[model samples]
Target: MTSNTEVFPVLETKRLVLREITKKDANSILDYLSDAEVMKYYGLDPFNSLDNALDEIAWYQSIYSNKTGIRWGITLKEQGVVIGSCGFHNTVSQHSRTEIGFELSKGQWGKGIAAEAVEAIINYGFKHMHLQRIEALIEPPNLSSQRLVEKIGFVREGLLRNYEFTRGKFDDLYMYSLLKQDLDKINSM
Candidate 1:
């Protein structure tokens, strides 16, 4: 495996392009992130302004620069506008592991776009980031996210009761993971 820190990796799927998000995309990011329905199970309150979106984009850049994580803006091939974002965070190189997070605009949900984009990044994590395990933390109420990860081969490890404080309360989360060996098994099948 090779690690090149200079170039931001851009990923592509059948219908989407996963690329670095610029300040120009803040409005698009705001559109979905501000929606209470989109933020319901996301652990954070909906974004209230463009600055919130800018701050988010900055966090993405900070993670990449610190070599701790990477996030990609999800855009349709035909539209070139960010509808959402997805990627890994809480990366621990020593442990060969990382946590995945993602969100999509309401219009894009149920279109399999999340699955396709997530699968691309999972492969990248294993083959390029040299990760042994990728994890997803899902709120119990987020059934769609749970299903998305399971469909991509992540197994539900267990429920961590009140594991995190979010949205003004402690929330229960289900931990799910996909190991490199697990992906190998999936690919061979």
Candidate 2:
């Protein structure tokens, strides 16, 4: 587990590099954040300008500095450009838990990139961070995200009705969770 004292960790999988988000990534951030299809389920509307992406990178940095969370740019090794982002949205150290969030460029959809990035983070969370659990929240309409979580071993934990207001309306969400114990079991196999 990374402590507040440690610098942001960079994680890597077979085809992706998960590194700390930076202002340099603003253009890449816009590659997905500005897309209607990509931002459809996100809490905010699609970014309309480069400044929005810059602000987003700053926000991500602030959370990392505040020790509240950390996000990584999901860069494909072959492309050498970030196609998405993923990381802990909240790290409740007291509970040894964190909530995971992720998004990818629509152009990269159906390529299993999300799954690879997420699995690397989950492994890092459990093995390095000593985290006990990882949680995910997804809008009910996002079947692909639901499938991604389930494929990563998250257990459906029911719904939170009108859990969040996003894109001008209250949206229902489903909660899913994965425990370290379960991960251990899977790994031992």
Candidate 3:
């Protein structure tokens, strides 16, 4: 559903709490904002102040609360911390597909968390959201994200020429996709 109100709160996995972001989470946003490594893929530098984080959380909350998109604040069960965020962004109206995004703090790396989260969201997209296909537009240089998408059964569709602008320049993107029919086949087997 493109409406944000219907999906503000999303499904969570064993190790993560996927909840709608709120203005109260200024501190949580601040936590991930401090890490340049995590921010590297966020398309923006680390937050320079708490007020910037507050503004960001407010913006996310507004869009998510309206059901325009689905965004989750990823909290770890062990530490009860919001270490990252993930969600589905509807795009390319003619294709009827949505793009998946995720970012986690450096500390949470190498634990299969990204794949796990992607799996959960993918299932939700096909089952609950009734999406026909899911897509991931990963920058060509991000090896870790590329592998993570492949791990969850998304295939390399092709490189999208000058598809995205990052760090002030247009760049090619490696497209990955998982179709609903294929996902259903995997789930049924």
Question: lDDT of all the models against the reference?
Answer: 0.90, 0.86, 0.75
* Candidate 2 per-residue C-alpha lDDT over 4-116 given as tens digits, one digit per residue, 9 for 90 to 100: 57778888788999987777788889878989999988898899889999898887887787777788889988666889998886889899999999999998999999988
Q: Where in model 1 is the C-alpha error above 4 Å?
A: 1-5, 185-189
Please, what's the RMSD in Å of model 1?
2.9
Q: In candidate 1, what are the lDDT values of residues 1-189, reduced to their tens digit? A: 114358888999889999998899999999999999999988778999999999999889888887889999999998999998999999999999999999999999999999888998998899999999999999988999998888778899999999999878999999999999888644542
Candidate 2: residue 130 Cα off by (Å): 1.8
* Residue 9 in model 3: lDDT: 51
Order of models, best lDDT first: 1, 2, 3
lDDT of 1 at 125: 91
lDDT of 2: 0.86
- How does model 3 score by TM-score? 0.85
lDDT of 1 at 78: 82
Candidate 3 regions exceeding 4 Å error are 1-7, 91-95, 184-189
Estimate the lDDT of model 3.
0.75
Q: What is the number of residue pairs that collide in model 3?
A: 5
